[model samples]
Target: MSLPLAIISYLILGESDTWFTTLGTYLYFILLPVFWVGYTVGKKILGIRIVNLDETDVSFWTMIKRQLIANIFYILTLGIGVIVSAFMVGIREDKRAIHDFIAGTYVTFHPPWQK
Candidate 1:
């Protein structure tokens, strides 16, 4: 959802291929806050949340770093990053991916009202 929005935004802005690489960077800033607030807006909507490896709420800086790392991988690979990210999450003890590891965070399911 967020990815599409970003692409659409770029298209609307008439960005060229050369500027494509920068889109991920822009999206990082755009999404970082959303991710930091409660793991992710999507996760929040889905009744899930992310915490740190230490079992505390994830910090804003951590989310920013995670977004930076994940978006870099995402841009480098055409779209393979998603698959890699999924596998990493699936294999992680706390259901975290490369981004989470870089940020020292863990994702977990939560009840809606609790959010």
Candidate 2:
């Protein structure tokens, strides 16, 4: 995502560290997911979607908490939290990662109509 903008910026301006890259990052991580009802490009490709625990539509602030706020803790742990989240998803009955718990959401293969 950011790679394309970074490459273009490098070609055009001889620099990759610019607002274009940042915009790409935000578009990929934040806006796209919120607008798509928690399905990012990869998730959509994989036929997965995120839904709130109560089976409601995911709001922008909820996605922010899930994607951004919970990620801060993972970064704080220097990737250990990410490992834990992977393990939790693999081992837990609900198959939810740390971010899902934090945001009161979960990933599901069920289509929206079923929910």
Candidate 1 least-lDDT 10 residues: 16-25
List where candidate 2 sits over 4 angstroms from the true fold: 17-19
Candidate 2 residue-wise lDDT, 1-115, digit = tens: 7788899989988999998787677657767767787688788899998889997778888888887888898999999999999999899998999999889999888777887
In candidate 1, stretches whose alpha carbon ends up further than 4 angstroms from where it belongs are 1-36, 73-82, 111-115
Q: After superposition, how far is residue 60 of candidate 2 from its true place, in Å?
A: 0.7
Give per-model TM-scores.
Answer: 0.58, 0.84
Task: Look at candidate 1 and tell me the lDDT of residue 29.
Answer: 48
Query: Candidate 1: global Cα-lDDT?
Result: 0.64
TM-score (C-alpha, index-matched) for candidate 1 = 0.58
